[model samples]
Target: KRILYIMIALCLTSFVANYSMSSGAIASEKKDGEKVKKTTAKDPICGMEVQKDKSTKVEHNGKNYYFCSERCEETFKKEPSKYERKTKKGNEISDLSKE
Candidate 1:
């Protein structure tokens, strides 16, 4: 009967919609609890490694600097030139290259 066919079609459509929605919700839940590794950068003032995401960040001269602690951050803030990168010149070597 036409009514029987319509009922079957509606049931199938409802089942498919529910299946898709539940699958999408499970996918989103997995993504919500995903763990990501954080990258590390050296504290310029103390030379200690610190996680980029967890450390205090400061920007100087268009560059970002990460610090292990507020003390180191303050030290760099006071004299950033002391921790600024040095470039190697002709017949010369950069100190950073040695590390």
Candidate 2:
């Protein structure tokens, strides 16, 4: 009887440990994917709205540039003069630049 009880306790402990480990991994993955969808901005160069995961970002001239596509980023890089206008305040700019 004591041996049976010990085996049952071990089985229960292993099951609990496995359950917690899998759940923790699933929760973290959900969090990671969720972080990308929270907020989005419009790409000034291409005039398209971009989500966090979907946007290509570049840091230049003490600012972060968000682009709707890689083509837009290339365009901005090739002729930065065309897109030098700053529309947001410094604090707002900083907030959008965060990862």
lDDT for model 2, please. 0.52
**Weakest 10 consecutive residues of candidate 1 by summed lDDT:** 90-99
Question: Lowest lDDT 10-mer window, candidate 2?
Answer: 20-29
List the candidates' TM-scores in order: 0.51, 0.45
Per-residue lDDT of model 1, residues 1-99, tens digit only: 975455445434543544444423222233447843325566676565445555678877667787655666677899887787666554532322121
Alpha-carbon runs more than 4 Å astray in model 2: 1-38, 86-99
Q: How big is the positional error of residue 64 in model 2, measured in Å on the Cα after superposition?
A: 1.0
Candidate 2 lDDT, tens digit per residue, 1-99? 975455445434544444444423322244635732334454556444455444578776676677755556676788865566644663332323433
Clash number by candidate, in order: 0, 0
Give candidate 1's error at residue 69 in angstroms. 0.4
Per-candidate local distance difference test: 0.56, 0.52
